[model samples]
Target chain A: MTASSFAFEPWANTHQQRIEQVLSGVLPTDELLPERLHSAMRYAVLGGGKRVRALLCYAAAKLVGTDIIAADTPAAAVELIHAFSLVHDDMPCMDNDDLRRGKPSCHKQFDDATALLVGDALQSLAFEQIAASQAPQALIQVQVLAQATGSRGMCGGQSIDLQSTGQHLSLAALETMHQYKTGALIRAATMLGAYSAASTDHALLMTLDQYSRNMGLAFQVVDDILDATADTQTLGKTAGKDQAQDKSTYVSLLGITEARTLVRKLHDDTMQLLSSYDQAADPLRGIASFICERSF
Target chain B: MTASSFAFEPWANTHQQRIEQVLSGVLPTDELLPERLHSAMRYAVLGGGKRVRALLCYAAAKLVGTDIIAADTPAAAVELIHAFSLVHDDMPCMDNDDLRRGKPSCHKQFDDATALLVGDALQSLAFEQIAASQAPQALIQVQVLAQATGSRGMCGGQSIDLQSTGQHLSLAALETMHQYKTGALIRAATMLGAYSAASTDHALLMTLDQYSRNMGLAFQVVDDILDATADTQTLGKTAGKDQAQDKSTYVSLLGITEARTLVRKLHDDTMQLLSSYDQAADPLRGIASFICERSF
Candidate 1:
């Protein structure tokens, strides 16, 4: 297929709907036991985001010649984790933020304690769902997901970010932080998708790891770019939050021009890794461009 | 073996040592990339409780003709989840306790944010360890553990508990709260031990679950009795905390004599369930008696 033939808007929208449905199906209903916690869990997950992680999961499934159905549970698992992290990070003791994705944060919408339980329960639910997958390597997939979200992965990233608050960090240090914090899960999302096809090829896994690393970092770089340039309404989150919180970001470390330049380089590197695949990898390429170029 | 031949003092001590060693081996060292998070995790898990959960795991393993070695990883995994829950529950927004296991709470020892990360990271690490288990039934073990720890299990219990704070609870409501909050994980600990041996016998699993629930409720009933009758120094935690917090308990709702009777009755029921097993279940019987009758 030619480059001009590839389209991402329709692809992303379709994946988002499917992902939302998958989440709704798996989450505990409010009519059942512990309705408030269930309600908050649903509230945190439903009615938001571009479902970029799910899209990546689907796109990676395509990379291995599988359909989106194969990626459904893993995709939802990754998003549940992402949503849980957001709920915790927005707590008053953490980021002290009141808004997330243009609405009240979980703690604000619910209560502090409910929000805390929401994160804890959601994390367990994600593992529970993934472990229930019929994929042959289900145990291995659980390990992969767990490792990415563990202390050496996402939680570790957030720890350093908290410790490094109000302190200037070198570019190497910042990269390491984001690598553990955000990049860990993004890479897991893509790898989980790739593994959802139950393929055991080590070489493809390595290539996908490289592809995911580049893509994950590129995603963050673009986010920093948007933070500096986009408005709150466009971003759907507090724009320029990094500057206000005195946290280091790509735009702050490097000027806007250099930050934008880094995004392009990472974007090219991501595409280069995906080029080994046929046009079936088009969604992967499309998402790379989409995430990097989106105004919000 | 005769009942008189069984002893819990040596058995529990040996299992505690073994569980501690496994925990140290699995937890990330503070020398690693995320030193603070690793440190907090270690601090939260090591040098902890009576290892009742680990003992239950080993006893359950014994029921299925497996030794403590077969039970090591699962035992440590349960303890880790237990430890993480305590850390989060001790935060200012939750129970706001200052001490756990006779030491400063995680938030007091570290900071609020570090405590949060410790809980988050420990939960992930627990899954990582269990998923790495070589047991034939590892996936189901994960599910059982996840469900026990999920919203409808531990977290759900905690949510209703937070909502019930300062409100009068009926005897049934209090029992329901403890069933989900404390009983769920206790039952999981025993079941994971059963599942650890990869046993497919439904009847035996059902028996063990019944034994666990009885033992779990009895354990809490004993706790409430102690809270009402013991001192902080002996309990290693604040005594009369529930009463002070306006939280209802078995002792608060049922009076001391009735609560004690309930504890004895539950203990009898637990023993009756274990009677169906051979002398191989002596350790289970011993632990149940010890939990219900221990001065501490």
Candidate 2:
């Protein structure tokens, strides 16, 4: 497909459905033993969210000329990690939000204990998905996923977020927190997809990583903008939560107009990083545009 | 070392220290950024417990004649999983206990949010440890640990336990709960260790697994006995909390005498499973005996 003709909307929609199906097949069926936990796991994961991580993974894999099928496991695995993080973050002890993706959060849909187990099991299932892959790169993939999810990455970012609640954070500190909490997994998504190829040069990996960083931060900036300006219905989650909880965010640090300006810069940087590649890079470029421009 | 000449006491002590060292080195230091979370992760894992899982892993690796060094990652990984489970299981939403390993549980030591993140981070760290292994079996090792930890394994068992609370369960049901809640990880410890070898036959894996099953059940029975008979000091946690919470246990169902009798039978069966192996299996034999006979 030519770069000009390649469309992000159809590609994203197709893969969103694709990952939902893959995740549905991978999660334990609700009919099995521990039926409640199984049901809650499926409930937490199998439904609604933008599969941004999975799309990024597939785009990066395609850019590296690997069979896109090789991207499936990492794509699904990153989505599982994302799902688990959201489930835990919504618990009473954390963000204490009641709405998520237009449904009651996992803890509200199930009990707190079940939600806890759902998050734990989903995390394990993510690794299980990655480990099931037969590629020679699978070992490194596990390492990458784990590193992104662990104390120094997503969880660490979360710790800072929890601590910073009700307290203002400097712009640098906020960015650092976002780097660990969200950027780590976002970067891993792209890196994992690229690694699906037989050989990915260090330079290419670094370029994709820089692009992913820009996109990850931009994604969060847009989220802050939406939380500030969108209604709960449009956001599919409680709006104005960051302000209500006194949590620091991009829009809080910089006004809405500034946050929008920052997103544009990030989008431009993301595009520049992919300029060396051909039409296969179109999906990534398209994703960057979508992230910065989307209303919710 | 010849099986007859090997001494369980010294072997156990030496390996226990080795694992403690390995875990300490692997866990992020408390002095780092997000220091509290890192500190909590270290506190939840290091300087406590018998390292029973690690010992089982090393023993099984010894039996299979792999370079014992190859066993370290899996050994530490299993212990990390065990620590994470305990941390979460102690939460008010779950077990609601304040004491664990004789110290305040993770939630009590830190706040509930930190405790939750500690559990999540440690679980990720466990996979990271396994992924860091250079062995060809590392991919399978990740799969084994994830399967043992997820819905079909430890978390699934915990889910059953949560659902069964304050309700009497049949002997078969209770056994099934313990099998998933505890048996799966114990079995994984041995299996992971065995997998460290260059090649392990399916039959040998089954034999080791059977042996592990007997040991795992016996370990839980002994735990129930200790919970009933031992002091908080001896057990290093709240004593009799199971009965206080109206949770079902082998001791609760079988009476002390019958439970003791079951332990004896399980110990004997474990020994029989190891009969074909010579002295290299002595550690496994010793561990099984310890599980059934220890007072606390």
Candidate 3:
């Protein structure tokens, strides 16, 4: 089937609205921060984007029959991590991108100094919000978020990406980088949703973890493909910028056709794992399909 | 007693050594991180000053009769926060000092980009280490550390300080900035130490909080004095840098004599608060005295 034949099911617009509300609620309201830092943070986070992390979290919680509101901390936490990464990634020393999500990057719209602090503040805020959360599962959720975003996770992945630039890497090296950088938090998003439901079944947690691993890798493979195929207008940011930087990507290493095939295989594998559960797993099934098929 | 006549007790050499050992143990092995990021982190963290924060954690834990080994996470966590702050504060947009603790600041030693990531990675690692800690008291310790280092704590204080630069700030505003910026972590150190000993008494925590608050401000007042009076060699970096930047400082705002008087009052008040705790609180007592009398 052609890509256009797949109907893009946007999962839970309500979840995105709720996450935006919570993010606005938790950010610093004090007047002490200059308008610049505040603006940079809001620009990075509140700017419209596909809130896929929050959606994944909400979808997973729903799959386990939990109230989606219970997933607020995890939802907000993932977005904060994502926002922080973007702020830093756009700095002149990193990707040096002048635009993001159809607007100026944090460092471009604001000064680099303000962008740096905004990233730092948002990151600290993410953990603080989780720790201060009143949810019954606050402590466990905080632990999950911290581990997923810290060294051996997101930051570790960034480190690998930074060092691997301009060098050829083995598939294993690339996968390891993605696992730490992207897969860790994606997996945490699913696990957080399950834990938000207060699920205690070890078996179910294990299966969701495996499903998340496949889906996370598949998500990155599709990202590489879109970078190759999408336009600036469609992608909402500069496309093919990755190639401009000579950075190694799944498409660069494996070719577009192979990357697409791998994503399909991973998508099928994830679906097979989710099949173990009954109707309670419907949301998970929907999210997996949405992730593979979504544009931009 | 005259400031010169007051005998200053040094940190217990063994306690200092133990903290050093713990810090070395918890940092990512050189092999795991990119050489640039890892080297910068090591240079910033191990390029030590007094290790006062770690000592405070160890001393507080000891006062409550908790094993020093159990204090490792809090000790490492506080140092990480301290290190990250120094790295950012030394950047071009902030205090902009090229040297820190008698060595080149991370940004000066490496490139600014690497320094930024080092600070970022260290901050993440701090939280990661606390969450992954195996100590029985890990959960409470993590909560305390997270709150202390987050917004409404250190980050918030920094935001205020940044905004207050070159602007005339009231004595109360100045106090508020120092309280948030420096006091939050200092208080966290004491609380972490107390909590490390498994003493969860609200009243005791309150008393230590009061003690730490006073001591933290007093420490900053002394820092202001040193900036005005000491030479670069003695101060181990640029002296009078604050006045040069026209940054709001206790000594600059209140004059040297008034700043000295405030430090003395804060020191006395801190000691009076700690009098109820007995010999176990000796480390705190010594630290309070040291704050008012230190030459640099």
Name the regions of candidate 1 deviating beyond 4 angstroms: none
Which scores better on lDDT, 2 or 3? Answer: 2
lDDT of 1 by residue, B1-296 (tens): 33467888898888888899999999988899889888889999999799899889898888887756768888988999999999999999999999899999999999998998899888898889998885788888888888889898999999999999999999898889999999999999999889888565788788888989998898889998898899998988888998889889988888898988888888778777777677888888889889988623
Count the clashes in each prediction: 0, 1, 0
Candidate DockQ values, in order, are: 0.86, 0.84, 0.44
TM-score for each model: 0.98, 0.97, 0.92
**Worst-scoring 10-residue span by lDDT in model 3 chain A:** A1-10
**Residue B117 Cα positional deviation in candidate 2, in Å, after optimal superposition:** 0.4
Better of 1 and 3 by DockQ: 1
lDDT: which candidate is best?
A: 2
Across A1-296, the per-residue lDDT of candidate 3 in tens digits comes to 11233233544566677888988887765453444466667778894787888888887787667776688887888889888888887888777889889998888887777777878878887777766665656667767877777667777787778888889889989999899889988888888887886654778778878888887898888888899889998988889977987878899999988888887788778777876576667667777877787532
Worst 10 residues of 1 chain B by lDDT: B1-10
lDDT of each: 0.87, 0.90, 0.77
Residue A85 deviation, candidate 2, in Å?
0.4
Measured by TM-score, how close is model 2 to the native structure? 0.97
Superposed by TM-score, candidate 2 places the C-alpha of residue B62 at a distance from the truth, in angstroms, of 0.8
Per-residue lDDT, model 1, residue A48, is 94
**How much DockQ does model 1 earn?**
0.86
